[model samples]
Target: MKADSEFKKVLTLFPVVLFGLAYMVPLTVFSTYGIVAQITKGLLPAAYVVTLLAMLFTAFSYGRMVRAFPYAGSAYTYTQKSLGSYAGFFAGWVLLLDYLFLPMINYLLIGIYLNAEFSAVPVWVWILLAVTLVTFINIRGIKLVANVNFLLILFQVLFVVMFIILSIKALVSDGSVQSLFSITPFFSEDSSLSLVFSGAAILCLSFLGFDAVTTVSEETIDAKKTIPRAIFLVTMIGGGLFILVAYLGQLIYPDYNAFIDPDSAGLEIAAFLGGNVFKSLFLAAYIIGCIASATSSHASVSRLLFAMGRDSVLPKKVFGYISLKYHTPVLSTLIVGIAALAALIFDLETVSSFISFGALSAFSLVHLSVIAHFYIRGRKRSLSETIVYLITPLIGLTLCVWLWTSLSSSSFILGISWIVIGTLYLAYLTKMFKDKPPELTFDADEDIKVSS
Candidate 1:
């Protein structure tokens, strides 16, 4: 493997945070609003609040880990350094599943939205167009993806702000303005703890992108400080967007039963709030948001594979190759793009569950890594440090387990099957635990090393 190729440190706080936001795709709040509200029985805001706080704990854990590792592998690097090679490999493998399917979910959403607008065009056409465009942007470089993501995220924010204002106006004109500030969106008589946590499990998907910031740590200047801040800010900002949109969206149509189809319910509300013209703008913004998300997803997943390949966990010649001129992982980018074509065969429900399961699994292990690294292995700590390192992560772990239980049975079966396959592959790689896996040094200079 060559050590000449490396990721340029062009990302500062803002661009890195923008990448996270784009990956999260704030407009997703509206895209899946009806189903979450249906699950929470009108208390969508409460669900987001729970999921946000839960994710924040995990976010803190990630921040701490990045300061120590500051590498491109995200949870894979953290868990490996904190726990062991085997644990890290599985962590990376699970996240690989998440990264692999995330582009599919984004393209699927684009296809679904486009299909709704132009019945003459098949959804597959829109999916292919989305994959092609995002792949091009990703292969160019992270800087381009960051620039594109910032603009698209701004457009998405404008659309959401416009939708909120229009919803308020529609309510005022109809003499029901009180719904805009009602507490029912946060908590209602029908809302229960079980239901809220269940909804949180679903909404956790919205927070998936924050951890991705850590994957770009090597490409970030002052990664130890910048990556942590980006992680925290992205989670908070994305959470705020989800809560605000869900709140206003609920105010517009407080009754989920009013939706003709819960899947496209947000479109119905868009039409009612601002007529067809505004609805068209809303659709355009959403499509752009999906493209931004797919672009970010591809960029991050390529980095992850590059990290793994650089470490000799996979084929170094292919997955680890980086374009010296572009400073991008060309082969890995194309691999993700090609794998996303599988999206055409699956439905939205299956992909959503797969993404959620893989993401939550990775998140749970990340929290555990914090405990493993700090409390169990690191030096003695003060009371405050103890709470930060141990107690908070334990709480985060419990919440993750609770959320994991909320996943569908199919998700559990499929997720476990993937894990089993990963274990089998690892056994082959290590010769049934008789040898140590390879490890690599990741830095801006692109140093490559192998440890037996």
Candidate 2:
């Protein structure tokens, strides 16, 4: 790759924020609404509140790290630079669970919704079609994916607005204006702090976009400034939207048990609010948005694999190879597509648990990275510096650990299995820790971009 062919610093704050929001897929609040509502017993908003608070602190840590190392690789780079290559390799490995399975989650969602609406078609067929389409588009190039995601994101935002308005209107029609105000969404007799924390653990998937923006640091202008600002903005805006939509949805339909299908509860709510027409529109928009999201995640994990492979962390020939014709990581993209086929076996809730586990693990590592880099290594131990570097990150790390406890036993089993596998691989790669693990380099020939 020529120097001139490298990533251009053309992105500004607004576009970067849009990219982050798009990656987040704001409508995802609906995707997990029913499951979370059931888990929290109608305290979805409170769960989101807990999640938002956790993300805010971690976002602060991410900002500090980006200032120190303004590049791609996100948490992996931060951990490697601050800690050691072995820790960093594990960070990237664990994070790969989040990145690799996210597309699978979207595929699972596509199958769930399309199968719900069109029962004649098998769910595997929809999953296959989605995987093929997303893989094809991603293999083509990133520019086309970017343009498509922009329009998809606009439609998703529009759908969320319409859903909120319709929910409010239904609330008013059902009772008086007072019907719109309810404490039950945040607190009810059945709701407990433990349940809310568990819900928050699942909902952490909704906040993945804030950290995703850090991957674009190398491509953004004034990335140290722009990326941090984008992270905070994305987290706040996305969290607020999730909280509001969940609040309104809960207010409109307090009886979570009434839904025929918990996974497709949002569709039932849409149909109740408007009619079949609105529900159809909701289904279409959501499927389209999931496709866009799947494409973005597919491309992201592919590039991450390319980075690790280029560093000889993975097999250089397979994982690191880029297609000459398309100028993309074709092999890695196909691997991700094949992995996404796991959607056929896994259900939405289980897959979400897996993603949340990976995400929470990475978040914990980032907080530790901040303390390692700024508080311990830099040694800026003034009272203010200690608070900024030590106290804040410690708080973030604590919250992340608390959330981890809330994850299901299945998540812990699967997550630990992944870690054990990574440990063995790291041992072999480094010849039993006698040599440092190969560090991943994010800036390389392959294009690293993400879209919704």
- Using TM-score, give the best candidate's number: 1
Error of 2 at 251 (Å): 0.9
Considering summed lDDT, which 10 consecutive residues are worst modelled in model 1?
A: 443-452
RMSD of each: 2.3, 3.5
Kindly report which residue stretches of model 2 are placed more than 4 angstroms away from their true locations once superposed. 1-5, 174-176, 321-328, 440-452
Backbone clashes per model, in order?
0, 2
Q: How much is 149 displaced in model 1, in angstroms?
A: 0.9
The TM-score measured for candidate 2 stands at 0.92
State the displacement of the C-alpha of residue 80, model 1, in Å, after optimal TM-score superposition.
Answer: 0.6
> 158, model 2: CA deviation in Å?
1.0
Worst 10 residues of 2 by lDDT: 443-452
lDDT of each: 0.86, 0.84
lDDT of 1 at 84: 85
Candidate of highest lDDT:
1
Model 2, 276-307: lDDT tens per residue? 99999989888877887787777777876766
